[model samples]
Target: MARRGHHVGVNDTDPPLPAGTPLPPDELGHRLTEVFDLVGPLYRRALRKVEQGEAVEGASVGVRSVLDLLCRKGDLTVPQLSRIQALSRQFVQRMVNDAAAHGWVEVLPNPAHQRSSLIRITEEGRTLIATVLDREHSLNREVGGDLTDAEVRACVRVLREMLRTFDHVDVDD
Candidate 1:
């Protein structure tokens, strides 16, 4: 039996919104704002933990994000990575530059794109990311105790769907 406030795959405070139902702009804004308010702090805290032992050089969240990606996704051109991460090219470029300065990544000439360079992770970066992730497991266990694995998986799926829908919806129109 699920505990109160521990329901899987649905909000506990309210009934589930109907499929294909569009919320009023104000209501949608309010819910999204609430989510950001709650989720943003968690992200910041985790990022801080990941950076704790990192060298002061290139230790900004932006640089860490680039290093994390390069370490996980193998080599990628700047634009390709920017698109995949849903970040602007300029912002990613700056992060990439910082990572390069710290020897966490290497920028090699891209054969297909003369201008965009391929960014690859260095051994040092991999080791550092590994260390961060090793710690993250404990953090995950600490926070995830409130939810069952099924509930967590369902929540992640719903969040991904919401992000996909947001990508298609144009708020201004």
Candidate 2:
């Protein structure tokens, strides 16, 4: 049985390792699996929170993601956004359509690809995404963990390494 706040198959009863404890390469995979287990639920719950906050604006998590990407990366094609987000091109296209309907984003001509138009976040989109991100940041600041910058960086490094390991995996598959 799983303990509260823990996923099944991960033994949460075990005392946590001391800070900076050296983990053997083989054991590291098992520990990282626990991290992955927690990440799924964390992501879902976080998505729900964001969706709830965005209810007033009628933006789903997917649309927010598309808008945020366009805001950060300037303009990009649906295929480019799909690849960057590891989502299907069709799904991304739907998101772009939703954003366009809200006047948050615009479809511009892509000189590089006649078939694929570039998606740009309009001024309205930029403002909405900025507000969303600001709210998220404020919520993030309320996280109870007294985590230091080094600890957060280490967490990011671990997540990045995990992402890189699966970078070659086809999302469509």
lDDT of 1: 0.72
**Largest lDDT belongs to which candidate?**
2
Q: Using Cα atoms with residue i matched to residue i, what is each candidate's TM-score against the true structure?
A: 0.71, 0.86
lDDT of 2: 0.86
Per-candidate RMSD, Å: 6.6, 4.1
| lDDT by residue (tens digit), candidate 1, 1-173 | 43323323223366646876775665555565566677789778877776664653436767767777887788998887777677788888898888788788899998988988899999988876676666667777777457887888867976686678667543323
Over all chains combined, what TM-score does candidate 1 have? 0.71
Candidate 2: residue pairs that collide: none
Query: Which lDDT tens digits does candidate 2 get at residues 41-99?
Result: 99999999999987776788999999888888889999999999999898999999999
* Residue 64 shift from truth in candidate 2, angstroms: 0.5
